[model samples]
Target chain A: MGRLTLPDADVIPFGSPGDPDRPGRGLGPSKAARLVGNTGPQPTSPPAAAAPTSRSATDADRPEHSTSHDVITDAEIPFDGESWLEFARRRLMGDYSVDDFGFDPELTDRVLLTLVRPLYRSWFRVETTGLENVPADSGALVVANHSGVIAMDSVMAQVALHDEHPAHRHLRMLGANLVFQTPFMGEVARKAGHTLACHPDAERLLAAGEIVGVWPEGFKGVGKPFGQRYKLQRFGRGGFVSAALRTGAPIIPTAIVGAEEIYPMIGNAKTVARILGLPYFPITPTFPWFGPLGMIPLPSKWLIHFGEPIRTDHFPEGAADDPMVVFNLTDQVREQIQQSLYRLLVKRPSAFG
Target chain B: MGRTVLVTGVSRYLGGRMAALLAADPQISTVIGVDVVAPDSPIAGTDFVRADIRNPVIAKVMGEASVDTVVHMGVIATPKQAGGRSTMKEINVIGTMQLLAACQRTPSVRSLVVKSTAAVYGSGPKDPAKFTEDMEPRHSPSSGWPKDSVEVETYVRGFARRRPDVSVTTLRFANFIGPRVETALTAYFSLPIVPTVLGFDPRLQFIHEDDGLEAIRTAVLSPRQGTFNVAGDGVLLLSQAIRRARRQTIAIPSLIFGTVGRTLSPTGLADFSSEAVRYLTYGRALDTRAMHRTLGFDPMWSTDEAFMSFVRRDSADGEVDVA
Candidate 1:
């Protein structure tokens, strides 16, 4: 299925790739122009030529290079002189601070996010909508439909919020136990500000005024057959709803489309899954047949839409404990995400386009 | 009208310093230091009583001294220090049982402060970011100091219930790190090249030696009822701490980290049990809000400040900062 219809602002704000600094500026052309003039080349790095010594060569060249770029960088790069060296020194000296969640703001903001930018921008071509629904400040639980065998959709959504939004807030993701059980990836996940998808961690992060993201669909949505692509799997016991209700954080149902096309899970090897202690052993179109090359997700055009927030604060004190209230809210969030998915699917031209 | 105090495990670092500090305090009338062996260095202004807490004689010591405050700091962290795992268990579990029994009998002992560990929370992938006072381990620990701490807490709770009038303060402290105290954590950091579990950067919290002692002193002077998590203001990622200490790390696999740590650091300064290995992988943090509010005790140094002080001073020399 494909669309020949013209792009609309109601579906998505703007073409994210067009604006380098501010990704989504379809709100207004005049406002975008005013912002570009005010912000300048600070948050993101300028073109290679504008700053001659933009790339760091070695520890020896750092001292001279740092002084030259001190004015341009001190605000964002944040160290007084020789930012790379100073950052390294500060890191080595253990001068840096991490939150109780082991979230390294410096590492996540500069390094981890930078690593994911290319995937979010060039590869996925992720375009987001209804960012205004996400509170600029304060806590909000982002309930999103999980898909894409590899789960690149979650990362893209995180990047979309951080890059596209006016406030540029980070989404503290609640991840599965597998993400944390695996080697190397676990540490990266924590440093990137992710924790185990547990009740306590979710409530704690929310109470601390963090934008918490949870994919209740989990592995069921991720490793499902390609035929059942857009169809949402069972949301986990509605734990996300309880966490939101407890913290009184409004639930923002986020819909991420085009991720299901990536990897295209044709079948699942149940025996292999059982042996390996994984949720499912995904047999994608390119995977196993193409070997390691198959791991590269299909360049599917991504569309993320944030729905209107469902207020949990209005509910009664013992609402979190009430199965009826939780079930109702969970269904509401699921329906909203499903509705947005259909809307986004209609707007996008094609999977690759 | 100063309170008479009885301190256990005065032979070790934390207990000896605690006894010395309690003896110096104007609020304490007499410091009766009880230990199986003599302290490594004599604790001034303390009446040293050669008493094994495992024996029933501790009750006699408590009765004779007319001790108003009982501070149990003898819970050993590492098995190597206590000769074996069984001995460590006996000292930690049975020793606490005997000590509590003695306190229960000695009517004069109105206040009890048991120094517990956050290890009772038990580190795992399933653990919460910060453990509150009431939270239990995700997996009930079956072995090591974590298990011992859990058992010790259970008995302390039982003691509180039995003796309704006695004000029992359970301070669940995070990892101890400072210039003077020599713990498994301190020894692990002091290594020429520390070995860490690969692919895991655990979140660790620390309470400086001075702050820990001060908290104990406060408990002794003005007793508080109920449990409290005693940690400094913040937490530290293990990797950052290693780097800050300027120690090279050889990361071993999670499975074999215990083995590598044992073989590499033959000095037995650090524990390499399954519980400790899990801790190395997923470190634990405590909610010390109750310590600040209920106990009215404020730590002078934060976790970061406390760790940095230890790294700065300890790495300079293997010797203790305080004489």
Candidate 2:
């Protein structure tokens, strides 16, 4: 039999705050309830009484949906379970949509991204800068150096763009054929919005106005020994360059530091890898000798820095067909990424700092 | 101009339906339905002719009737439907060759329409997201009806080049799903416990039976030269389709994935061969912009809508709704 009251912290974090200039418009049961005494559950509450003041304000006609939503947010602790149950029910009833590339946005955002967020945030403690270089909308190809033998670097960058960027753009990655050949990894990668590293797939994603990511270094960059770490590998015949040229999408050269220390490959068992039909059997300091537990990535300090976009629109038509232009562009992107990687290395205090 | 049209494979559902449809058209003076066996049910408008297209006798039928428009819809999809794999290949490859040879000889034929399956663009992991009409399959179909289709299209092209007067329209239709129609996919979905490849949810595209027939009708009415990919707009994920069907799914390991349809589903109907397994592993999509701009055919149902329509008829409750 008392007025509804809540602390500001109880408000939902999802919605932005309403106008402070508009009095009594915040759906504030907090300040008003304390002042109005225990004359409980009255139809004429303080907010209703002060409605006239709000009515005279600039946004009087605007609804207090945000205020109500904010209050509803975090109001009930068990709502997440209910909402998740609802999501499951919807999924069961086939009420979701997916892109032609088999990208399930709902599942990716709610499940896949949520699973990796902890690793990106606390475990790796990834620091990302220069994300503003990525366009808010429109197609842009992100060319990053591949590292972290397990491909954690790409996923970490994906998480960074989704969580940190202003646009929250989904980076549709161009993965190696090997990724799609594997069972669970292939399925998860597609759901996370990745396709084959072929030119057609890359061009198609770009044409659809999506931010596409490609690691040109591929296996060589990831499988190199710890001693050879941070040395740029051959950027795959400039296929990514031609794709950018054809789509007229800007190529963003990205540099990722700290991934090299994750596994620290000391040697490679070539024959065993070939027998197992794998690219290379990596022999990291703790791997194979320490068993599955060694699979755990070291908590290396991570820094993902996105550099300025290399414009492809300025080039004349048929530049993609010209090997000279493509090779130069590929080299330019490589140098930019390598330089930034060194810069980030100097900026960081230590490996696990 | 009431010109006579000859339709092949009239015993099959789609082929029979196509014949009846063409027969009903006032523009066509006569619709002759040719096949190896008698139609199961009586066709209303079409004049059934029990003649095998693989034989030179088909040329006689075309010549006597003075068939001007040839609608070849006889390419059987499943081995069971054709009795065996060899027979399916014989009918698809050899029958197509003979049919094209017959078409080339018949001077009256002016418009030739072939119903091709999108499976010709073989599915593989290293495939593009969407394949255009000109793009070749990354992994050429090693076996089954997909390879047969490749051969069929080739012969059709050869016939096209030999006779430039005829307007050759090849409509590459995606998997068909509807209440009345029966296909390998429908048979697979009808299994008691739907089995899927573990760790893979392939992208699926479907065309409603009505939309498919309408596409054929569109091409027949307004003949176009180049091949066009025909399917309802949008795509449905295999997992989404399973959920929509309200079926329990068992994920089989990829190692044992090849024989899933053969072992689980009824003995013969479902054709989950190597090419099909590859499709279930990594799905294929078609670029259908040309279907709209060049072919001038707009499907009434989107991909998911076509799938949901099938699901609606599949279950007794018929209560399919978005959550």
Candidate 3:
């Protein structure tokens, strides 16, 4: 596959290029023409000539094929913010309402929210100490440390948020490419509102003012070896901070206790993994080799805490560019979430204890 | 010179045949036949003893007979008759162990010959190749059939290891056909509306009753003490066998019969249905060259000859055969 590159110019032009004041106006025809000229138009002809027929041989019979260079790249595809919003609306028509996007407009979302309450009660054992901390209606990035080898904890967090909050927002999760490649699992993930965790995807969701969730540690956090349980894995040089900085969304540092014990990875068979085309052959107490009997996770009573939101509006523009500042800020946020989880772990007894 | 021999399960067809053959031999003075119930008419000059080998009385009986060799064939041959592993363990494993222990106690008993099954190999390539005594048993849980065979083999090996004085020989007998063959193969072929292959073939091996008895007689008489696979002189597919029998054989996918048999019959996972599927679909040909080389004996009848003899006998008996 070819490498994915960022667009030369931003797809959604929020304000005038090199200007701050002019916002919400669409890029004019001159800009559109320039963009088209730079990248060329989509191919309008087939690659092969049509077979000759006895019925008619007209001027259109000439072998016409567009060159590969004529096709526009993703970078040059013009994005109208209103058009995208309308597209998303149309795609979700009838099945979903505006209230479904975490608004208590007609109390329909409240009923749907009620439907998943039992699952929340059984799964997460969700206890909200600071219900006041969560804004009644705002796009907040709930940053939680991912546990469980396959981001099952992240799913439970989504389930918990949708169940507890009256608005019932379905948190859009940013997942890795591997998650989307698995057979039956990929479809289930898309239905659960999880998209590939790329800069463009994250930025687009954030720009749309949707509640986005991310695990900075990625697979490293989930697939921590048997020796390191509950200990956080390394979070790569702060891409999450940059996304938050660009969108000015509050980062709600969340801590989820008890997801670590669900499936304890006792051992791993590297040879089996290479043969099966899996990243790791986890020898958990139960798994892929066995049936439903293996799928059952050890019942660990869950406790999810939504910490006070850390506002990003105060930071000056381009604060993400300062390496030292970004590093220090990312470290501080990581330490805060880590310490909170450690404290929670100590406060509660074992899942069964 | 006369020798004394103890044969367990003498009431059964193969055991009875072995007992009668040994009794007829002038070298054998006395033959002790052990069973739960004594045979109505014992083999000529053979002593009938009522004793379950699973019980401790087996050692006492062997002690009284002072037999020179013990041929153990006292096992529930079919899984349905055996019930489950526990029941099979009581009869096959524990019973074999008890008989082995009895042989160990009797000072005169120098050899112990046990009847094992070729099904111990489970399902594999039917490449007409020989499987030596050392080939590991394929223990599969798809059905309890393979497990039962493996367990029996394991118990025998353990017993052999524990008793160094006794020379143990296990014979893995092939599918046998004779006058009284009542297995699924006989039942399937004897049916009025015989199900034959549409076009596909099946490789089968059958030992005649007399030849099977000769194999046991030779094993008991000879002082050799290793395992050997015993089968008929040659191999033939079911279609070929039916054709040789001069009977009309239809051709059909073996799976259809298996599905129908499983659905219609009460013996869903019995050895009969499983063996039928195994033979008709995935037939295996065993190499019995070692039996000829070591025992200096060859099966007198081929599968076709034995099966034809069976068909002739059935016809003469005027039995109503239904498929």
Candidate 4:
């Protein structure tokens, strides 16, 4: 080997200074050999070591490649796709776990419970009753009245379960598509362990022995006029009952009061809403025309009451499919929840009562 | 024969109540409540018309109703919602122009009572003496653009000048409080905790909502002309007002407090964006002698009385922890 002497600062190690013809050095021998042919005795120079004080003139001139900056190596691939348990453990210092659907365990519950606590406190003030009726361990399907144009009541219900319940069981919510469409909101929903309330999602969560919540009234229920605040909207085809029957989960009818007063929909801007591609522009004391600043809900006191769970264990497997059975079951649940809310309202003196 | 009066912005907190009060009076035969959003139900015997007063269509409607007086209260009261002086000019200035034009075309229209604000003063001197109707608006060119109050006042004055026969009375109202209040300042001061200065006291003034309604009623019934300062007895310091709020006081530097408040509160900073900040910081004791003398009106509640009433009502309702 010939001695290649250079200045102290200019010294380069062999195979370090990439050959003009060969760019990817030390990536692997095969990649290096492919770049620079193995046929000749290429002069072995010291690695291209630049002085610490010197700026590399060619730093900005690097060639562009097809691969992304965040590409993972083949070795990084786990046996069965990335497990949320492992990812959360490594990323979140094992402080988090994965829910049934691979959501951040600790964060999912934390966000859900935190959002629900204030709502639960508010709910207690308005119409809360039958806290003792909630079973300690069994999976239950909580069907509640939904009102408040934005479905803020659903969030209130989820919060009620997490904060008021002794066991602190995480209630998986079925959110609407509009919620997921809003920016910064969609990610929060998913991480908080809410999924679409479609049959598959309901079945999956219920089958895993997890408490599932469904608002049968959906948009129609929550978006009712201020005049019809406490009135429950029409429940759609008994899909909740079918989900309960399929998973053998008990149906727990729930009612929420005071969510209606938060943002009273005094009027609607139908023309503006249609033009802007929105459901309906609510002319509350604040909203859309007022911007996001308007969305700050009035701190109205709330009340939530959970009724005794109707056991479906004794019913036949396909009992939900029977029209008469579904209709009767749905009516019974709705009437019970409605009556409880009215009684609670009567007992309470005012709107914030 | 009973007279017909047209009131716009009747759906607003102040305007709506004013309409209700006017409609209840037996002297007013027909009260036409005009607004973009009509009330769910008509105000007793009053006729309700869901029409944007800014629109030309209002002239046809008002003419048909045989409106003898036009009480122009349909204004974007909040500076935050008004956008800029141009916006204020558009709705307050031009809206008045259109309504005035409608009134002129309607032969029965003889009077115009405008609900202007003491804001026209734009942070006047804190002297105990009251301002007269002839007193030149204390607004300065250096104080930035005119707010809705000033613009609306100027527009009404110009309209009065052109149409001499049409008796125009501009009521420069001070801070008024009563039931169904929606002002940011009122809500802020009524909160469980009010952010205020320990030593510095800015003068505060208010008229009861009933008093304000009474003033409007007086303006409508009487043959009064020109401008009048519709205010209570005197001014109360910011400290006194905050204390009256009954909420715990968080003493913070005005500048720092305002910065944090503007960030956290929706109405806080945005409300002050207009020259209204000048009035908020500096003391302005408005003179209400003209309102009392001209309209033969006396406010039932003073600043202290109004504040205590608000605190009592709010506390009793448990809407807020006044203590």
Candidate 5:
């Protein structure tokens, strides 16, 4: 090593240009070859040879073996695995802030969404419709029906928007307070671009030209019994409508089918939910019987249909403050999504088809 | 252009340095540096007065000097530094009470600048993302530097009410980190294996040492009348700060960390106080609108840059460079 000592060498191994945290594997041969070209005995390589000798001459007065080897190498040593190093690098270099809401895109892309993408693609076999309804590049609220014992439906919708849509827009999802209060889940949710389902967070995201997704029905939609599958619940107190009105974001009412069948909730374990400090402990058919294995969602064919955008810009100022306008808009959005669910159900042959 | 200024706590680095800066100004005729003990390094062009602020005789210093301005920079940061917990309280709380009392008595002292910390806004889960100067803390701090700061501010408020003519400026600063400032935060970051509260990556804001001194200088020169939240803009998460320092972090369960940290603090392994633990768990950020809009002063460094400056000077590789 002519000039490239431990202090001068950057410990963060350049993996890929756009995303350094994205692992670049099987590069030992090429990197070793480059090292040979730089430090080899052959002095004929003009460009590489000239670069080091000139710098080493400038460093001539500097003592040999001055750079602390044992101490420097110990701190600079990358861990064994690629992913751990990526995680450590992200954690160490302050590469965690992707959004003001503490969403780390690298973490979401490489870790969280990486785990969800397979489930959305192969396991659920989700086929999205009316992707054109999603605004190609601007801010729009995607209001979808929520279900499944877990919020796999919402996770899949996020994957759908990111992977399939023409613009590949990232959904700044509005999650429940429960999702943000729970220990590990809270961090994962925030890193995956999910903030509290509050108006301020929603309005800010929309104002910044972000696609925000909200399940207005909330736990009522997710924790509903199997008998009420495909039946829509109360669309909240119209908070999402108020947020859209405040920001003038067009509301794209989305309908997601087959999430209702993923883990069909047959009973409610209210006592257990209370003890565990959860909103609701859903008891499904295979849940109590098969244990952790039953938590695995069925390979239900998912149909996500995006309806036409409902314009809120035409409304005058203070429309968000007006309860009647907000109520009507909420009802209109709820009606559109309900109708889309009915139309999509007619086309589907079976839940698993 | 001739003005007499009294700078308190000249024994400390910030206080001693600020007094020297004040003295160097041609407009200022006199700079009197007051402290309990003589400063280790001399403050040029300033008369050093060895007198504790806790004593009643400090009132005589203000009265005799005919001081027009008072810069109170005598706040104790840690109990360990002040000899013990009770002594820390006496110096921080009683010292402020006496100083404010002396200012109240002296009619000529029209300008008062107090060095305060952002710990007045206690860290808790219910706290707002950014705390404005006027907003009350969600949970009022019960102990340590936070509680003392709150008590000091209360006394200052009382003083303001009594002497409405006086221009009172309180600079509630974020954690100070720079090339030379060895604050509690710096000490924590300097640890080989930094212990972090599990599942909480709290956001932290820092002001550079130069920025902090500049803020104090600005307060002295301009004589603003308001309690301002002075901090560098933007924020760095606790984990990110540790990472930037190139220090290894061990995620410790909060309960276990609490016991171990408390045990180790006395041994001088760490400067972990209950207030510090709360801060590490739920970090605080200040809304610097008052600093920018009202005070009309801009910090030289942002939050990230201030933290990086400290890291550049303190990291393992930089150790040799520092020497």
Candidate 6:
């Protein structure tokens, strides 16, 4: 059977040569066209005259053609971001439980977590205090200050918990809905043990005797301008406290410092964010100016401090339903995190030291 | 008390097997198998009737036979079996509408079991890991068998509303794979070389043909209210499933996966439709807790066991008559 050829250059232009924004780099049209011509369709492309009708005719003629175990010469397609070995490793570690949340422990530990370990340990030089405050084996809601243009602190905190804590517990983080809606990001987040930051999901994870993490500051803390960098934003609605109250899981107010300096959000592209259906399109000093290179996060000296765990077991039977209790508890946790962040910042010698 | 049961699409393997199985039951006095064409092998203790379910005459047939229960197994899974896309759609959607209309008119029909598919809960990126019976499809299928299944189910719901007394059960079976079953999934897996969407390994679930038949038998014998998700326990990733099938895989980018799939779809190696590729991109699974707790039935085979069984059967024959 003859091989099917890719459409001609005229028909499918992936990236225009003249598009300045695209920079004609990173697996652009030229590479795609070359890959298609050189590496695609191993059996040899059908003759130009036979191109259109070739597929159907070939199909009709040889119905049970056994190409099983044949070497697929067409490997170098677009999205050539990961090496073959890396890709294979990811595949091997992709198994997960039958839960509806789609959390894959193998993928998270071997791929996603490992992918960021270097950044957390060496690049950020992260130091953690009061690690003993985190419960050894049971469910607890770790409430932390959310910062950085991107929420890398949450991931670093996850790494800290997984690597440092004696019990090596996993933190099932509650994330924004936007992350789950996006294509690749959504899948990656789920595999890394993050679920929708709604009450039901949070309560389920907590009740299951798993460590749960929440950054109630959300987009406000992450997308704040550089001038308001270390200042803690108002924690939203006290939903995390309600979840803690309902599950009777202790709330550990965790604080992270030095994250606000990484990719400092100097300006906001509100229009672009709206178009993309994102919370905020942040513009740092290096971004757009340096293109893809701007995405490289600055190596900041990090410090994460865990405060005393607040006992929710003492709350009355239906304290979760009480607005005043939820509100007061939310303020208490927020205040602890805010105070801890200030203390950690004062102790640090320099941002990148 | 004996039942007069009418089963549709008797020409198909599962339909014929189910009809024959039901005839053996002491509770069923008579079983009538109706199809557009005759079955190759005559099923014992059953009467075969040649009739187009799409025709209004189906209502008369249901009335004349005094069928107390109706088993609608007429839904087509693949385009090739039904002659083409348009024909499959007509037989699946229009035929179902006509059959349900017939069931609505027949007051003697106390129970209805509609064979449905898990494809209605499409495999989208944003879909919950496992689909429960209650959740709607993340994205409604645009065309082909999945679309038809959605329509068929909608018609069944409408029929239920009209006949409130009748016990309606919709068993949304996961992709069926076994020695005797012929489906799009089986055809795709039987391919010598399978091409998959690059960088995506979706979880897959399957129910053995034996389990599938037994579920139908259970539904027919002990009719239940509400929908149930019918799949074996556990799931297999697409890559792992291919490895088990002992087939070579070519991973193409999503950009060219469609073009490559379009080229391969007609080749008869795989049923590589746009919908099929979407399944590959985001593999689908169903939560069968309802199938156990609500429907009160457990599949004999797990997802892995079912696929392995199919692989063993295919290897023994080495050639499948895809119809």
| TM-scores, one per candidate | 0.88, 0.87, 0.45, 0.45, 0.77, 0.77
Mark the regions of model 1 whose C-alpha exceeds 4 Å error after superposition: A1-86, B318-323
Candidate 5 per-residue lDDT, tens place, B205-228, comes to: 999999998998899889899999
Q: In model 5, state the lDDT of residue A6.
A: 30
lDDT for each residue of candidate 3 in B207-226, tens digit (9 for 90 to 100): 88778777887888885677
**Model 6, span A1-353: residue lDDT tens:** 23223232021111223222422111211232232221212223322322111132232122111111121111222123556577665454432243446566655654576678778777987776665566655678999988898989999999877654434467889887677655577657776777778776788788887789999999988988876766677799999999999988888889898788898888999999999888889899899679999999989889887666788888889999999999999988977777776566656667877
Task: Compute the lDDT of residue B298 as modeled in candidate 4.
Answer: 93
How many backbone collisions does model 2 have?
A: 1
Best by lDDT: 2
Cα lDDT listed for each candidate = 0.80, 0.80, 0.60, 0.63, 0.77, 0.76
TM-score of every candidate's chain A: 0.78, 0.77, 0.65, 0.68, 0.74, 0.73
TM-score of 1: 0.88
**RMSD (Å) per prediction:** 7.8, 13.0, 24.8, 29.7, 16.1, 18.1
Of models 2 and 6, which has the larger DockQ? 2
Evaluated at residue A326, the lDDT of candidate 2 is 97
State the lDDT of candidate 2 residue by residue for A44-95, as single tens digits: 2222322111112222222321211111111133333557779778878888
CA deviation > 4 Å runs, candidate 6: A1-102, A175-187, A196-204, A217-219, A233-251, A269-279, A291-293, A307-336, B268-274, B317-323
DockQ list for all candidates: 0.66, 0.72, 0.01, 0.01, 0.20, 0.09
- Model 1 is docked with a DockQ of 0.66
Count of backbone collisions within predicted model 5: 1
Candidate 6 deviates by what RMSD? 18.1
**For residues A63-99, what per-residue lDDT tens digits would candidate 3 score against the true structure?**
1110111222211322323354563443332222221
